[model samples]
Target: MHAEVGDTVVVHGRTVGTTDRRGTVVEARGSDGPYLVKFDDGHESLVFPGPDVSVEARA
Candidate 1:
């Protein structure tokens, strides 16, 4: 549930027919998310991820 800048965030589809979303953490707020993410589609949004979200560490 925690993420940092440069890390990747995966938002799994919670329901059938919905595709997964992948984005990079543009601005991290530690555990206080509603993080700023830049998606692969060239859009940005503030997302407060839930249990369906996974934060992958930057390597």
Candidate 2:
């Protein structure tokens, strides 16, 4: 997977009935690595996303 800074990242809940999380990519680690994201709740994390994650480019 590939993402650029400013892209939107949607992380699906790991369990049923849980709410999904959304964040903006603040830093991308080359072509293969975890991305640094800033969530809407004012938190930041380096996430190695799985198949449940989707990225939307900034238009």
Candidate 1: 10-residue stretch with minimal lDDT: 27-36
Give the RMSD in angstroms, all C-alphas superposed, for model 1.
1.3
lDDT of 1: 0.89
Where model 1 places Cα greater than 4 Å from the true spot, the runs are: none
1-59 per-residue lDDT for model 2 (tens digits): 88989999999998989998899999988775499999999899998978999898899
Q: Which ten residues in a row have the lowest lDDT in candidate 2?
A: 25-34
Clashing pairs in 2: none
lDDT of 2 at 8: 94
TM-score of candidate 1 relative to the true fold: 0.87
lDDT of 2 at 7: 94
Best by TM-score: 2
Q: Given candidate 2, what's the lDDT at residue 21?
A: 89
